[model samples]
Target: MAKLGAPPMPWQKYVSDVALEIDPDTGLFAHREVGLSVSRQQGKTELTLGAQVHRALAWPRQNIVYAAQTRGMARQRWEDEFWEKISSSDLAKMARIRKSNGNEAILWGRTRSRMGITANTEKAGHGPPLDLGFIDEAFAHEDDRLEQAFSPAMLTRAMAQLWWASAGGTTKSVWLNKKRENGRRLVEALWEALAVDLSAPRPRACYFEWFAPDDMDRADPATWRATLPALGFTVTEEVIAAELEKMDPAEFDRAYLNRTRRPTPPTDPNVPKGKWPGLLDAASKPVASSVALAIDVSQDRNRSAISAASLRPDGRVHLEVVAYRPGTDWVVPAVARLHRLWKPVAVAVASGSPAASLIDDLVTAGIDVPKDKANPERGDLAVMRSGDVTEACGQLADAMNQGTVRHLDQVPLTAAVNGARTRRQGDAWTLDRTNSLVDISPLCAATWARWALVIRGPHVIEDYDIADSFA
Candidate 1:
């Protein structure tokens, strides 16, 4: 893991120790099947990655299979995040990488130990005596066909183990739902019946979860700190609060709180039920090209938003609310972080708006926010004039009205768009951030971000996103 530039965190270490304990009597893995459930942005991915690398290198003639929801994703992750790091280091000499179309693998020459990435199908683990199987993105599974196949393949290995891991999922995740319920039942029974000492190392089945209780208040910072394992590391209160403001209640619960349930419609949603719902597309993602960002604060200064816009290859603009937090303090640091990550054409803020107040703070942090209006460059700030604000708002309305735009099914952004009202900017109109019934900062930020992207051009390198990247 140190060689991969991703040493395990404290929680990872603890979880690995518990879940990977060896049975003293049998001299084999205590846990045959382990389920790990945690919120997103935690180091769960890194934990699984480290486990696979260790198994491949340490065990002679061992075979390992790692899976995501799709084969392309699994292969991409293996090359970009896992193998790339090893190939650059001393580990490359220890292991050989094969990139053939259907025969991709990482093989250690001396031990003949090998690892492979697989597609999500019943045959994922077939044709191999698997020692370690790390099945990821379990939330996306609707059936147990893959598990049934993998478990049978692992039966031949003396030290075999199957790890089915994911965060919370919607009701459609039938397989994961059953596994979670079983794990929960075991945990409770062990606690009540005193089946075995909690500290003892006898694990036929391992269930580790970090989930928020049903009764806790989602908005409470204390609840967040207590529920999320990676809260302090990189996912701060500010980041979680930002996520809360832009995401659907169900999504926020599932992704951040690890509480999966049916997606319920808000009783009296701020966003209208009509046109906006039709535009909800969960698969829409912004390309790295023509990237632009914008910052905004609520009228009361109680919250802030940072949004992104990018030109899709199809020539459509991808507008997204990137972040929304509780206060102004974290906005500058977040902007700086995102700027470094995306390297967008510019970061925009509307003049006379609450976000404009951050100009000085942003400048103090060495992020360039030019006061006077000039031709803005990449790595510089784009301050929108009153006319530009109206133009941006009008452009966004035009796009939405024509159904030329797409958005991820985020409830907050949808509500913001539906609840937004217009204020006269001469003949044109601007989003009324102050007078809107619901907070419209996210929508305003998205509009300005899209405008900036259209006016500027696209430029960004492909991302090698770290699995353990917290903030």
Candidate 2:
């Protein structure tokens, strides 16, 4: 990045570490889809340029596409931004620009590589196999037709990677929204499976988002510091304060906070009357030799819960809310401490839930939650997918009804159980934390812990602490 005359920021380098990782086995890109959703004016254009320029110079005969909101705007950018930068630099001798009216491209004669500028459309991804694809201003896209068009061409290229960079999108941004959700789930699944259980299949997407949740105090400088990567460089707290004063609240959120509003979720569900209180035993404790731990974070990112589950001597599962704490910064060290105290069979969390946010932090804490997709039940980090989540929810409800589970009479756990709500995942239903009246992290943590234990019954615990190596 320094060679390109624009030194990259820490966050940009951080994104590159994960998204640009090459798989040693395949000697190719580890992830097919790479995305970044962040606050506006965080050097996304420069970041995109760096990737496109590097790929063009590094690879031979690479077919790359850079699409913006429209063809005219794309061409304007190519002439004003990209060409000017490349031409003024040392790359001028090796580069060639074709600026014919409707169709324009940047060409490298020696490598025969060409980057075409276009408006993102259903046909933006057409022609010969695409080595790399860029969807600039990705939030403008309203549907998946372009992605549908891009997938086929990417299939033939062993090192193909599609990049999407955008600020948070509006409700009309169905394409970016789907990618955001899927990428979040994939990150959750990928880190757990790859880091914890190497034998598990890998996820195809790599994503990073630096944006505050919609509920955060946007007017605060602290909020801006957390979300805006360009702080102290291209951006400043004073400037942000000015933006807040001048801009509309929602627009300020979109431009500066990079927050998008979502449609309201389903109303509270009728939780099953499964003798919840009757199953509570003041003396209830896990008697199983091996333990399983689960973690959950609230949607607001305000609170977190860590729960343990193990079997009772008589056969019933024992569940306990071990920790309920404010904020998520302590979750990693807390889990690491617990793992040493109890060599759990699996550390489980729902794949697509808010708790998934912890996957990366846990990995950085020297905790590996690799996935063996073929044998999820046998892994150290049990990635509870939508199906697995629904199954676990059903299992918990059934166990409560059948009096096969015992829980310590914890206040937080009881409140979570009483206030929990369910939403259909497909044919089955999973806990809906967002729609619940009260915090549901306690219920979520216990449910996943119980499921992980039951699924991997009577396992030999891995005695070593994964986090200890880092320490």
Candidate 3:
């Protein structure tokens, strides 16, 4: 990084020590995966670039893939830092830079090695046998779909390594939290081991993290330095203070102090207290007009809810929970029965373990659940993503506040609305079931129903008979 005019911070050097560690016996990277969790703007990119450059130069004919959550982020990193550094250095003569859209690559002509930069998608690293994979903004990736896509390519490469680097993410950061927790456990176990167990295999991953205590005073300079390793040099106290003034305190704690915010009910919730009640109309009933059905199972799978929403003649949306059941066993059958009764426009199901587990049941119930949006025969099944959930929650909240939503004032739905807590991801907010005091499945179902009603547009309802078992 210093040779490229961007010097590494002290913390970055410490990260590099572990990330670049090599096993002498195998002549390969000691850790197959390296995870680094630290504050933002702490010279993470500088360290990553330096590592990439080192790999490109040292290993001949190696393929490296650098991916971010979005294409724009990957493109910006390639153009602004990686390309700029290479173009200014003598290394430019040894490589050929390809700037084609969606196929950006840097080929080391001498060694026939190549480095590709692309967005983190299911098919991002499909083509190449990657020697090294770098996942930037790792927290943004909620699942292992992208990793699973790349793992097959790296399986045969004995020296292949995957690196994940990011700051603290929200409660939805399941993958990142797993990595951190696993690393911490390994470290603790090793420290407590009094005798070497030669027969036991060594850990295949390394995790490095720096964070301030949850209760630390944000205004204290001592706490700032304790949390931010680059405070005195690359970043300053004044800059952080200004940022603290501009950002939400919880957000600041996550991005700067690297502290995961305690999941608590928001003081000013996305769905205001009285707004939901105002939107409720006890006399509201399901319209004969085109409607959308949404099914949601609680995280524990102990409860399931089926909700319906449709546009009323008065231009307002009417939403109501059709069924609130005790277990998931009856969900698919109930939905199949509802489909026969309503012949609705679409059935929206959120993507996660619950929905994934229901795919087989849905198939058994004779529902053709399309895998992707491009499927020509969608067959009334709409799989909602995390982004879709966020949008639906926001839309539902907005409609309630605007008095454009009318609910049936069902007890289960009312309880869900009252208990739902906001969980923010970037600028988007979704209901946080993990932090909610009561079941929010009804609210989730209603949100999805509303989303499907508005977003799916008008669809021709096909005649289909409900299976005898479902009936």
Candidate 4:
């Protein structure tokens, strides 16, 4: 409902005025979560940052958290951008803003109110309890992980509003896709397909998605306006045109137009004809305490190669390969041989295939094939994988640069590793096709599982020894 006589805005209205109503009294929305998808240069970041500041200013002793993907981003925001603005702005003159080494802050105002800020890790985000939070580029995070990270900010005295903003992502499963299609359906049929009743116990949270229509001709401005509500007036036509012109056609559609292209279900890149590296083939010595395992699936016409290596205690990972033989079920038998010889506690198979039946077969054969979901919180399997792979990749890169890690005589795996280039996917790294061995995904998964069983807590490496096969 409009206030009795809300003044008209010459430029744009405030976020509170235009935002969905959560609570009727405070004019504060009580959404469990809020998602916003806007095209680039539409003031999404500004709106979100302003909202955080507003919340902090409105309430005294409020604890606010603004999180990006990495510590560099964290520092960039506080040291380079936000705090710089605060120091320069009249707001700093009016308020007493105290900041610590790139992490904490205390803002005191004339109203005798204070606002604090902190960076949160995966395990700690949901631990502290929070008043308000801002998640920039939320599409990149795994499902529910953002919620966990923002859990600390839910302890506000009055109300807590979590603001998430992003442009678009490549995958359909991302939260951004849901927000774009499901928030408000056009017709009853479309509604049935996309809409969820907001009244559910875990209500469909409020979200706003802004993008150009898929079919819109890029040359026409009118066609763009229909899709990008932020255009002109606020976003300005010139800026939008420049951005569109700069992007590739496909990328433009996905990022700016919000068009869904047939996603290619993440295919494994073509591996060049090459030899497999042996354990003794290392050009350099292993890290202080490290483990590596090779997984070969046994199936006719479905031989897959996967290798995972990680350091003990430190959650670093190096994924070696994921190659498949076109016609032969060699994976199962090969994996069995590797198991008998090396006794690796963890081996990841790409069960998201016909091979899933084989996983059942393996379980029947007394092989451990537990679903990844049933894992620890702090010791989450996904966390371990991501952490380990990142660490491993970094270590591997350093070794390569320093001539530390040498391939046993230059095998296919060595060639692949040498040719590997990192692709940026949000805050994480995805293997670019050129040097990929079989696939990097499975290797990453196996490394994470290995870390959970090995370096986590008091557990030792569980008698899995490849050294006995030395003979």
- Candidate 3, superposed: residue stretches over 4 Å from native: 194-201, 261-264, 267-471
- Angstrom error of the Cα, residue 389, model 1: value is 54
All candidates: TM-score: 0.55, 0.56, 0.56, 0.46
Candidate 1 positional error at 355, Å: 56
lDDT of each: 0.79, 0.79, 0.79, 0.49
Pairs of colliding residues, candidate 3: none
Q: What range of 10 consecutive residues in model 3 has the weakest lDDT sum?
A: 462-471
Candidate 4's residue-wise lDDT over 401-440, tens digit each?
4332223332335433434446654565644533443333
Ranking by lDDT: 2, 3, 1, 4
Candidate 1 residue-wise lDDT, 1-471, digit = tens: 677677777778888898878878788777888899988889887787778878877778989888888899889988887788778876778888999988899888988988888888888888968898888989988999889878999877888889988999998999999999999998887776555565644338989988887656688898888778877876788989999999987788889889986745333222233666665666788876467889999999998888887666555667788988799899999989887887787888899998899998877776786444455557577778898988887777667665656788565577677667776778777777766767878888888887777654522223422111111
Report backbone clashes per prediction. 3, 12, 0, 31
Global local distance difference test of model 3: 0.79
For 1-471, candidate 3 gives per-residue lDDT tens digits of 777677777788878887778888887888888888888998888888888877887888889989887878888898888888888976778877899997888888877888888676788788868888888887788887767877888999988888888898887877777777887898777656635664555688888888887546777888988988888888889999999999988899999988765465544457775787677687877666558888888889899998988776566888989999898988888889988877777788888736557866777887667556653242368778788888888888778777888886677887678777877878888888898867989988888988887766444433322121011
